[model samples]
Target: MTLSWSDPMFRSIVWQVVIIGGFAAIAWYLVSNTSTNLKARRIATGFEFLGRTAGIPIGEHMIDYEPSINTYGYALFVGVLNTLKVSVVGVVLATLLGTLIGILRLSRNWLISKLTASYVEVLRDIPLLLQLLFWYTVLQGLPAARQSFNPVPGVFLSNRGVKLPALNWEAPHLWALAAFVLGCVATHYVGKRADRIQDATGVRPRVWPVALGLLIAVPVAVWAALGAPWSIEWPVLRGFNFQGGLTVSPEYFALLLGLVIYTSAYVAEIVRSGILSVPHGQIEAGGALGLRQGVILRKIILPQALRVIIPPMTSQYLNLTKNSSLAVAIGYQDMVSIANTTLNQTGQAIEGIFMIGLLYLVISLSISLFMNWYNARVALVER
Candidate 1:
């Protein structure tokens, strides 16, 4: 049968095809133009420069990196690792802190609520870059290693960094870590089994005790079996700086602090709004069932509020990740910073830029996919 314009479906299909074709045409033109322009400039292209020596000094690296010996590709990988370290840690800390602040914002006590409100207001208003700069400056103003502040027996804070006792990781630690992971998997299955039992028997079996055993007891047992070797290397004053311990660099600390504080404020608002979105009647019904206020919020309110909270929370997570690029401002070598350095030295501006964009795109998409999956899990399902 021939389609007619009068048919709504036919018209919709035609319009969608037109829009898609238009976008495709424009994309092709832009690509061709870029290639033509590059050719005219006689600039070298492709990712051949990635193999060349990087010779770029990176202060804080998770992986072993040598500036003079490492290739540009390896340097970029280190930069990616640095970015992931900050972004991942920041996301987790921001979520926990944000959830607490959001809950406190709804407290019955006026003082607590008002204080939390002010916190959200001030942080949301202040510029994150300024906050980062302020934190970095404050860290810089701390006394040098000679007059460092010893907070704990093995903890020292100074202009150089925060020195904490380092653990001499042994093979037993790896076995313990593996046991912990296995415990988590067992706990998940146990929880699922409990849920199925509840659905079938009209009563839920307690999973927490079993989870605790699996998550904690099993790991401890594994460590003990392997002869847990706990060795601590404490920091001691060297000539100009502290040595023989784990050091938290000022740049990383400031960046993490600024991201967590700033993002938590926004997350607080999201949490508050999500909780408030739940109808008062639900709380009343929960209370009528003789449930405590905390239980009511947990069992009834939060489960419902999550539907509203998750979508926006995903955006906050993405923002926190992208904001990590600002690490360059304070001399923290993140992906963008290192990529810029690579571009400058290699003169492969196009390739460097494409790689940077691609990396961020992949990272952002990964976060989005995970959040979306979790959201679906928490979403209300209708019979």
Candidate 2:
């Protein structure tokens, strides 16, 4: 009747059941409490409120939205587009600036390295909100429209906003944009082909020339063939204010600048660390094999360092995107800003906050998923 080793299967099954049951019990308890509290507060939850009219003006809506006609759902969609616009531009600009500064920090020239280090320290030490406030103040303090600073004939800078000539795009502009997209896709495939050819044969294909031809040449050719039916609408300083050009509001500019500079500092550090993580032996070996410095960096270092750089860069991007919520302080009409306004106007605090949280969560999760996929693609394998 003594216990035997052959009875191990029964014990394992009992433990597994106990562990799962415990987790399920905890989950049920939490949900039950949440629902009870919500009911006690007389709060009805779900997505029905999304259909209600959002009688609020969104200053910078990407889509044509009317305060009287559009629903909360449409307002939220506009907010989403604005958030994406800022985030995408910020990510691209930050990456470029950060990579340049990161490389400079490691430069052989002492002046360049020290200058870059100082830049990283100074920018990172300042609070992002303060920087945004400062930029906004500066923009607000500029001269009036009559004395607006015009660097070029059509571009006017003033307290009101930055005004620049815009293209009145006809059908040809759309065709050009389509051609540009196709050119980018073609260049990507061409790059892959070049790499494969280089790997298979000792001869390196001229990837940059081919890429330039596809990206610039093809797009220009298509644009020209379509008659280039676009005209520039110049800004003219009339009696009171500037007119006839696309104006970038001070709120938008300040938010964009602050996000870019603040995030670039963190991105710079990530890039520097990633580059440093590449073993010195690799560089030395490349040099020993008679490869030039530029060739070594482009061909050997970047591919390896990208694996280290991409994850932290992704985090910085997500941080910048979330930080855009601070636009509420400066009246940027971003998602958080619009949602806060809605909450105050409608007194639907729970619904407004839920929508805001959901939007941010979705954006963060999407970025994380993309970064995870990229990381998997570039991760080193060990046999």
Candidate 3:
């Protein structure tokens, strides 16, 4: 007998259902057995313990969190904040420095190109953890407070860390921050308008003038109008230590420096490759049209190269953020450091590890999502 297309025999639906059911049964069995075994071993489960007191001090909390009063959840929040603080600043600085180096690596000047190449190679070859340790050691070896290196009258550098002038923010400072944010938004829109103008009329708008006006001029005007509510408190060597300034702890500095240097090497390579990926014909054509080298680079190459550079750079940023967990190695009191302390003090290994994993996952996912949006904006459409 021949089977028709609609025949039940022709479909594998029943078999598919059976296979899925079998897998589900196995999973259920495994879970049940594991739970029983854990219970027999007197191991606890669930996240109810998160509400309990953490009873561990987090040394560098941005929020008002005390070990005696705060819950495990609050402690985790502090850790997350510290991680973000290092990661965000590191990402911005690394990208800026790396792109400059990468562009330099492609320079016609032999010395500049070779020097950048050497920097990328040398830094990339060393382990990041080792680099962190090295930086920490260097900071530790700096002269004591009495003999601290003073690059400026207000700034002091010692084994403890760099002490720089801290700005005391007042009402005017809030206005300045608001103005700065507005400037960034305005610059973005200005760039978009310039692109549209270029597309329609082949005329490149002077983006720098507009950008400078928005970013600097507007912010300065607002700051001046608000009477500049900013006071600089400088560090002074007093009583065997520096006092009255923003002290960047050695651990924090070492971690930041290590993360920046290590991640910058990868970012530099990404940028160099992205720029090189741009067709030489495009540059020659820009030159043929009487555009200066700087104009060609700024108006043509960078915009195109950014699309290619951004995705991989995003991965590097994620790596840097994750690698910051190694801050525990040097006692930085980052999330991992404090979390480990909590685990030791409370004997809550499972809860601590889960918290650490979840915090990292959230950070990683957020960065990835933002990068995706940016990538979508910059990605080219092909016919």
User: TM-score for each prediction?
Assistant: 0.92, 0.88, 0.87
By lDDT, highest first, what's the ranking? 1, 3, 2
Give the alpha carbon lDDT tens digit for every residue of 134-175 in model 1: 999999999988999997898999998899999999999999
Name the regions of candidate 2 deviating beyond 4 angstroms: 1-46, 238-240
lDDT string, candidate 3, 75-119, tens digits: 878988888889999999899889889889989999999999999
Least accurate stretch of 10 residues (summed lDDT) in model 3?
Answer: 2-11
* Winner of 2 and 3 under TM-score: 2
Tell me which residue pairs clash in candidate 3. none
In terms of TM-score, the best-performing candidate is 1
lDDT of 1 at 24: 100
Ten-residue stretch with the least lDDT total in model 2: 1-10
Model number with the top lDDT: 1
Q: How many clashing pairs per prediction, in order?
A: 0, 0, 0
* lDDT winner, 1 or 3: 1
